[model samples]
Target chain A: MLLYTIYLVAIVAEAMSGAIMGMRRGMDLFGICMIGTVTALGGGTVRDVLLGHYPLGWIAHPEYLLFTIGAAVVTAFVARYLHHLRAVFLLVDGLGLVAFCVIGCDIAMSAKMHPAIVVLAGMITGVFGGLLRDILCNQIPLVLQREVYATVALFTGSLYVGLLYFKVDSSVAQLASIGAGFLFRFLALHFEWRLPNFNGDRIRGFE
Target chain B: MLLYTIYLVAIVAEAMSGAIMGMRRGMDLFGICMIGTVTALGGGTVRDVLLGHYPLGWIAHPEYLLFTIGAAVVTAFVARYLHHLRAVFLLVDGLGLVAFCVIGCDIAMSAKMHPAIVVLAGMITGVFGGLLRDILCNQIPLVLQREVYATVALFTGSLYVGLLYFKVDSSVAQLASIGAGFLFRFLALHFEWRLPNFNGDRIRGFE
Candidate 1:
């Protein structure tokens, strides 16, 4: 019940973020809703599809679509005042990122995926929604170039797996991984931490 | 057998195209191979995932990855000299597009999807690979803004569905649809056909 509640809140938060981006791009209302829904659910959808998990989450429970679409619509109507809640938005987003990673890792582990793949699936679930959003917005993925956003996902997923391997209780492992991951993401943001930004400008040929 | 042969050639051609785009973006060898593979296989993968079809084509036939990656590597090495084959390349691409649409339609039909969904699937199969390529390259998808490339796919799919609905022989339907679709694409390219590009800048709000 707690995870389900977090998942709902997460989708709503993700949808609003996506809607904001769409508005910035001058997209129509339909495009905004589409981007929002995709941003909220696209990562998990991709993970499930890759693992051959049937009946995608949103498809099986169509109501998730309603939540995302509704959030986007609300964001579109009230975006100008949203800056006041930027801190709250970011915090929720951090929580959601870890929650998503944990959920993704659990799915892969249940399916008996390779350990590396389980971690990778969790990272995909955590970061790929934004990746998909960026693609739709016609931009390079921010996570690919920005601070340690995906790194947080990878860390959370690996930790969750590691804890489970050590025979940690399921709920405790989930909460601990999520808590640590959220802190990491928050600190990364606070300190403006980053990985190397590869510059291919000097690289010659093949072009 | 003919369709399978065409599919192989198509993936090779698509991979080369994606490699060229990646090269222009100054991506390294790994990036080039990734873009190439994604461009070649992404369309069908997306189609199958959306339709809940498992054991994806490339997964089932891992050799397809070999063809796409090999093509990409070859392109990266010899791209400077490839300009001379522009006409031939374009012809092959057009043929491939139609073939892909037909194959996609057949799969969706066998799955008992709605006729409209089948046609849409065909169009998605023809276009989404290139769309994914552009996304990786961090640009607006060319097909989304360019001439009637996707239009050709839509036309071909609708025609293929209609032919089948009329109970035409399967082989005849395939050939007829491919031929017509290829012609349509060729003419669209030659004549610079396009759909309306809505200018959303003037439309206020949401941002």
Candidate 2:
């Protein structure tokens, strides 16, 4: 139940981020709404589809769809005033990332998938929405480029799995995973840390 | 059985297109393989997931995945030579689009979804792989820009559904739909038919 609430908060934050990205790209309202909803829901949808879990979350619960659309609309109106609050938005987006990771981990754990698949599921659920957003905006995916983003999700999922392996209470595992993941993401952003790029040298080799 | 064979042909064509796009973007072999596989199979995957179908097609048949990857690798080496065969590729891609549309409509009809949704499923299965490829390549989606691509898919699906409704034999309906759709796509390409853009007038309203 608590996990569900956290999931809602996470989607809202993600939707806001998506709306901002769409607006920055000078997209119309329809485009803004599309990007926002996709960013908020695309990850979970991908995870569910990949896992063959039927009756996708948003499909089963239409309210979540409404909530994401509402978040997008609100962001469209308020984004200009909120430009100075980019840090605050980043903080919330970071929290959203952790929340999504934890929820995804819990779901994967319940499914009893292979450990590697479980961790991958969590990371994909945390990161793929941003990937979709960047793609729609015609930018290289931020997750694929800079920041310790995907790594934070990987760590969070690992921590959650480890806690469960040690017989920790579910709630405690969830809280700890979210807390640690959130802090890790915020620190990464503040420090401007990024993953190493492959530089595409091999393509040149073939050429 | 015929549909299955057509499906295979379609994926190979899409995979080649994806590989060419990846190569043009200077991506390495892995990236080429990734884009190719996604472009070939991504549409059907999206359609199946939305409909809550289990065991995605590529998952059920790993050989299909291998086929797309192989196509990508081959294209990476032979793309320049194949440029002269653009017409042949376009023809095959058109056939693939039609095959995918017919298959998608068949699946959705079997599931007894709403007619509108069945058409939508077909269009998505026909077009989304290209959308995925363009997004990953950081370009405007070809479907959303120029060409009668999605419209052809939509018409193919509608015709198939109509034929089925009129008690046409399934095999005949499928074949006719594929024929009509492929012809339409080829003619559209030859004529340079395109949808009108929204022109982003409303975006200026906010600015």
Q: Which candidate comes out best when scored by lDDT?
A: 1
What's the C-alpha lDDT at position B46 in model 1?
90
For candidate 1, lDDT tens digit of each residue in A18-113?
A: 999999999999999999999999999988888797788898999999999999999999999999999999999999999999999988888877
Interface RMSD values for all candidates? 6.0, 6.3
Q: Which residue runs of candidate 2 sit more than 4 Å off their true CA positions?
A: A26-28, A195-207, B1-45, B52-130, B136-138, B142-207
Clashing pairs in 1: none
Off by over 4 Å in 1: B1-53, B56-131, B140-207
Q: Is the docking of candidate 2 incorrect, acceptable, medium or high quality?
A: incorrect
Candidate 1 chain A lowest-lDDT run of ten: A198-207
Which digits, one per residue and each the tens of the lDDT, describe model 2 over residues A106-170? Answer: 67777889888888888888999999888887887878777798999999999988998899998
Best by TM-score: 2
